[model samples]
Target: MTKKQPKSDATRRRNRVDSSTRQPKPPKSDPNNFHGSNNHHFLAIIAVVFVVSSAISAFLYRRINHPSLPPSFAHQRGLVKEDVTFQEILTENSRVSENVTQRHFTNPVLAYITPWNSAGYDLAKRFCPKFTHLSPVWYDLKSQGTKLVLEGRHNADTGWMSELRLRGNAQILPRVVLEAVPKDLLRSKKQRDKAIDLLITECKDIGYDGIVLESWSRWAAHGVLHDASLRKLALQFVKQLGDSLHNVRSQRNGQPLQLVYVIGPPYSESEKLQAHDFGPEDLRTLSDSVDGFSLMTYDYSSSYSPGPNAPLTWVHSTIKLLVGEGGKSLANKIFVGINFYGNDYVVAEGGGARAITGRDYLSLVDQYKPTMRWQKDFAEHFFVYSDDQHHEHAVFYPTLMSIAERLKEARSWGAGISIWEIGQGLDYFFDLL
Candidate 1:
């Protein structure tokens, strides 16, 4: 009360700031404080994450849409790593054909018809004009001797004649599968010669355009030994058959009957997972003995597992082997197999898968509307989904894009292509042709 000594101006201001009722002091603002810096830092971090995520999503989209982006052809046998590109293949395809009238595909498009199935007939009627050759399964070698026997009713019926007529001048090369024959009979030169003669006579009598000799060890009960025998006899049969068939003009058209040999995958001798009798030497021999060779590149992973019908990676590997110096000479005459079907499995791991045609697969996709994704590593499309009971299913198949990549590979190597079973393909499948 000592008359609250007259306060100084500075003392009055300090008192005002300290007093709660004094104008409610304005808050302090510091640009370098912890809360302000922390907020700015968080905003900066968020911006960086957003940019990174957007970039990753874009990259994945590009990869999935265009799976056939050319890889380093460095290890691929035929092309120079730097020179080969997808653009180059497209250009080659567009190059003018020798027949100035035609600028279409240069390679032969062979369609395989399983005569036992009605679908084959439908495929023949629908796609006959599009194919370069129609290979109808007609004959199978007998177990008793190297005898050619009719496979099914279609072989003996006049229906094949009408079907052949629908081919629009396409070659009618009946496929003669050497599957059920005894290895011993095939090994015996006398029996092999008899069989070759019989095949030629039957082909001439039947008015077929040509013949395709298919040898599969799995089709026969014999294991490695049987494969070995067939492998040895394959060259003999091919050489004899080619010499005999080509020398004898077809009674119908007076043209040299063409001969083709369907071989197993071009695996190196070391990898013997499947029973294979043919080796590099056998391949070369067969190549020498036939008008051309068709490598069975499909069925790499069939109903055995939930996997791609034909993985592009493996197809590339097979291409490398065939186009390599070892099999280079056979490149032009080679025809790689393509599957028009897929495999559907109960699980992605171990289970018996069922064959699904391209058409059937599309219908299933529509029905289930499952989650589908492009498998980048394999260069194939696969999907996973849960059923009503929550049972997961996986389906893998080829799309037009994937098949285009394969065709590119074949074109790069100057090889032809053949569909495993024409009936399984979707109608649009022929559109690519």
Candidate 2:
């Protein structure tokens, strides 16, 4: 009915406007909306990265802070779940009290370590801080044709030395046994010079701090000490070697090389001065030439006697004879030897004694359960046990008390202590040191 009349322009325009208003229009794209979606994606990425980074950081921290023992060391120690005794001992002794004060020694605390026992290697590393000098019984000076040869270079462990240095700044003075003929070496100045040069070269190349010359015993065995002239030559050779070593500077710290002389103790108080044994006079002669005099004060009783390894009286007398009266200054350079091994002797005809380690002692205690006796006079521990064969055996070993008493005596004299070996003793024995 409305279309019947003529349509006006305003009406047409109004209809068109209504149609346009009713039609759906495409929306405009908002930059802010796109930015919000991108932000959410970025946040999700950041969360994932943070989780991964945290895990990595945690792993690294554990590795650096709480490092486990090297697999090789564990293997060398024969560490297994079955060794309950060893494991228990390790667990008990390994935990050091942070509050406990470390023992300080007036003189150098020297320890001898051998390669035959893996225990020595482990103990040396664990107790690196306890020693001022570590003497590895490694090198041997032997006669090779016209030239002097230094053997046992292959036994030098650079990695172990580095680790020892890192743990504690202990000087690495390897024990050098003199296997060369005394007549050939001490008699000829040329040979002596060659030997000194060889030793110096080895110290420089292997980064050794010094050498522990063990020739007095060998010289005594070869009868060099019996001859007064030869003995004088031997002394001169030692002095020369020491002077040369002291003159040369170490590549590691530029410090002069130290020379330690190993000397044997007198057999008895009434022992005559036959020049066969290194005595107190030798100490005085070598006080300036050597850094320290490692006196072998152990082995007072041998396998034949089956007595204490070192009697307190004997040790006291030995120190007294060597240091003399008011000899505090000389005592400072003396490193009295302490035995860590024991002798197990069979109390029967044709029976002999055998050396044993702390582990062996423990096994004996477990199996035999013998009556362990502490001899106050000798300051040692001894026990008699019957094996499965019904054969009686006497074992004489150093107890913690004995070690402590010996240490006290040495300290009173202002003398340093030298452990004959670290491997043969119990884990707790080191506590005395």
Candidate 3:
């Protein structure tokens, strides 16, 4: 509005330029700048940014505190629980069973009996004395007579362990069992020497009080020991026992430590059982070879008892037979037998079919509190029945009451009983004897 200088070209050009054509200001290039250096717009912008930042931070924080689920870890400390945090022990309803925890006597035992054959028995209701009503079978043993052995390799995941991940390992392994092989098959002199060294180390590793060398592992065709080298090697093994970890076993005022060998009577017996004439010499050789004897008295007459009736008399006769007629003191070194389960067989018309047994008969019974009948001579009771399929089944389960009776009998007979095994495979199979 300065009165009109329509003067120069530059001035006219400037005049033609519209003030409205000028560019607005650029945004401030920094995080500090919320809005233009002008109004309350900057304060509103700052507030919005804070809430968004806080939400992202919180989501990230929560993610770090919680993690994944649990898996069974074998290397856990102590008796680990099934499904819980590693730091927490499952102290729920599974308390220690009394059958497993009954009084452990330290009375010097006359003999230690192992139900060796208890290994393979089905422990089904038919075979076991107590569980005739509920057929829960013991799973991981291999028994051949009164002798039993556990090879945790095939057992850790069966029966009570069918579902759980079996995490622990047994005290012994195949290599350990093989370590004690005799000098005959031994190739190198160093190996024979090392067999002694390694066996002692292995035994120490496995917490064994003593070892029972099964005759089946090494025996002569005549059922007597063939290799004098094996006996000599045995002495070396015993020397290791007496000298190494578990010190010398002192039976009478600390005598030399010893190990035992159970030379089984031939597993196969002909219809005409062996008398003193046929097997006595072999028995004598076997007796001379080991510190003691383990006599398997279970499957003699093809039946658990003399009759189909429960608790037939052979249970006592088995012990009586061990004490040869006119013998002064019984073998005094004998460990007798007992069966965890019973047997079943098909009587072929030819009278030649081998008896059916594996104690699998218990699988057929309806054992929901079946009645228990006692037999006096055998000191135990048993059951025999047929399945719907017409297959005959027999069972001999033991309850705590029955086991107590067995213990008493065993003590009177000159020793304590070694339970067929240490397994948790029965429904209520723990001794209700």
Candidate 4:
């Protein structure tokens, strides 16, 4: 240090100033200086390299794991399974439950649907509001009529019925019958009882709303339908069946079960030439046993005989005879069958005809462009058409207008009306209903 000289006031003040507080040194100009801007430039370069390297690593990893996929395809690859999840099922079930309570009709407008007709379900769904009950004709007995069998159908029918019930909120009562209640089974009371029990169990297990018992002969075991002993046994069997059905628990309302007994046209003693001839006593028992009875007012003329299936006058006369005896009070419990089918008779000597649907008849009418007329006496729409073979054809079919007229007659009788079969694609009839 030089000989110390008394410093000036400004110099002393400057020296007293704190070195820590001194202005930082201006960055050095050397590009390689550790404390210079070159350090910041180096750091930036390293950062850019790290970012680029990370992106490249991610891309390579994806390519290794999932080859041939674009960068944007990452999300789409994760969704592979295409099926309804439990969450979706839960939502649908909730929706169906909410929808089932809204019924369109209080009185039953029952529609009979055969299992072979898949199109029936579609038409049923479309015209669900017009129907209050849907009876799927499926269950039938073996030829001997001892055991119940599913013929021309599958177990999936139950599922389809359930679906129809759920979606349409219509009561689903399937039709059951002993195609020809075997004579031996009827003779053996034990066998008849077992069959009845099986029928009940099957109905309950399948969640059917009700059942239709259609037996050709009250006492099939008796060679004669009018045998007094056979008739007595049939009465007892029906009574037991009714009691058991009433006792079973119902999925709907938790009440007694619904049972329908389909009977042949009730005829007087003189008119009892038909196979199933049940006297007034038998009719009384039927009226007393089941919830309701259906009169099959069709098949008076079959394809074997070329004539009207259900003549209006004949049906009316039968109805009068049914109520003329002990069954007079059971009119309200009766449902008249509305046959949706017809026969086209050949004008030749054979008097043979083919079975045709209402739609089929309409198509024939369109094809042949026949001379059509409505018969007031028969209450049927008639047409005469010549085929390409130059053979004259006579067609007598029930049209929407005629069917409506018959329905009015049924309603006047304080009875219900049921369509013989659905899935005719009868939009005209569907709209009318």
Candidate with top lDDT is: 2
- Give residue 381's lDDT in candidate 3 (0 to 100): 43
Deviating ranges (above 4 Å) for candidate 2? 1-101, 104-106, 268-271
Write the residue-wise lDDT of candidate 4 on 272-299 in tens digits: 4333454455567666667777677765
Say which prediction, candidate 1 or candidate 3, comes out ahead on TM-score. 1
Q: Write the per-residue lDDT of candidate 3 for residues 111-197, one digit (tens) a residue.
A: 111123333223321222221011111122233233334343332223422211122111111111221223332433554444445
Quote the positional error of residue 131 for candidate 4 in Å: 2.3
Q: Which candidate is the best by TM-score?
A: 2
Q: Is candidate 1 or candidate 4 better by lDDT?
A: 1
**lDDT at 67, model 1:** 30
| TM-scores of all candidate predictions against the true structure | 0.69, 0.76, 0.42, 0.69
lDDT of 1 by residue, 252-333 (tens): 5688888987765643322233334344555566565588777766654422223455655556556555455566656888
Clashing pairs in 2: none
lDDT of each: 0.55, 0.67, 0.31, 0.54
lDDT over C-alpha atoms for residue 84 of model 3? 24
Q: What order do you get sorting by lDDT, best first?
A: 2, 1, 4, 3
| Model 3 spans with C-alpha error above 4 angstroms | 1-101, 104-194, 206-208, 216-260, 263-293, 301-333, 346-363, 367-380, 396-405, 424-433
Worst 10 residues of 1 by lDDT: 1-10
